[model samples]
Target: MTPYENVTFKERLHEEAAKLKEMSFRDKFWYIWEYYKFPIIGVVIAVFLVGSIGSAMYNNRFDTALSCAVLNSRYDSEALTVDQYFDEGFRAFIGLDENTKIDVDYSMSPSFDESAMNEYSYAELAKLTAMISSKGLDVMIGRPDVIDHYGEMDGFLNLEEALPADLYEQVKDYLYPVTNAETGQESFCGIRIGDTSFGEKTGLILEDPVLTIMSNSPHTDTAIQLIRYIFEQ
Candidate 1:
């Protein structure tokens, strides 16, 4: 029996339209906000979320061809140079497309000496552990101590098994043996690269640099190719 009881949807629409036409812009905005504030806010938030998700997906679209980590590196200035050199050179050597990515991480600098260890070192160690556990890292280049630290955890692939016979034989004299902590078995886990022309070519000042491939690497072929490419260069 109320005045609204007789009103149809079309009549309500017309009444609102007429009221909006007579109102000022500010009044109209307030009126609409009063009526549709929740819906407008919800739509805006939904759009923002969608845009954020789309951007993230697009940015991460490329597949990683190789993921190499340089731990406890002495030369901080060579990070960009190393990253660019390997990324471009390796891509060209392998004929990889632009859509594929090669990641070279040089940020980690974990200290082996307990007295020298700090929060940053601990964080770097955690990051390295996470990367290895997730199979996100393919290769590691570091000092002998750094290489041995991870090798003790059985982190690296035995070069005898991981590499082709010819390649293993080629670098047999440079092999760095590490004893597995769990099994107490000794194996060749890394190859010494510091004595090579790697430092001069890459502008990295390495002292006893060793290269090791991860045991759980998903890109073993690519990693092997990388080692071959390094030696070739």
Candidate 2:
């Protein structure tokens, strides 16, 4: 029986508009907020989600030509310099277009020793595990202990199989043999780079640095090329 009960939607809208027009700007704002706050918030959230998804999709459109990680690095300055050098040099070495991306991550410093392990080390290990599982990591460069830890997990490709026969023969003396914990089979999983001119050329110091290729690398050819490039340099 109320007057508004019989009014059409258009009529009600006009009445509300007229009321808003008569009110001060402050009152109009509060009135609209009181009635439409939920809808306005929903619109804002929807816009943010749409924008995030679009950004992710656009970013993923570029193919990752190669991704390498340096673990347990001691000097941040040297690592950072080498990181930039590799990012620029590798792209040029491979003759990749700008659309293709190459990443050299030196941010991880995982400690495998029980006494040295902490929350941060565990977090880095988890991140490394996730990247390897997703095939996002192509190569790993680290100390002998770090390489051995992952090698025992059967995480690396056998250099004998991964490298060209001639290349393998050239570095055969420097091969790091690792025994798989599960299969008990021994394979040459890493190449000892510390003894090479790697430290001299790159200025990244490590006691016994080794390079290993991930078993599930999507870019094995690029990984091999990277190994060759490192030794060649």
TM-score of each: 0.71, 0.70
Model 1: per-residue Cα lDDT over 121-177, one tens digit each: 555665667678878789999988888888999999998888898888778889999
Model 2 C-alpha lDDT per residue in residues 1-233, reported as the tens digit of each score: 99899999999999999999999999999999899877776665555455545743564688888888877666645444675456677678878787787877767888877897654555566667767887878999998888888889999999988789889878888899988999999999999987676666555666788999999999999999888877776
**What are the lDDT scores of the predictions, listed in order?**
0.80, 0.80
Q: How many backbone clashes does every candidate have?
A: 0, 0
Model 2 score (lDDT):
0.80
The 10-residue segment with the lowest total lDDT in model 2 = 76-85
In candidate 2 the C-alpha lDDT for residue 23 amounts to 99
RMSD of 1: 13.4
Off by over 4 Å in 2: 1-59, 76-80
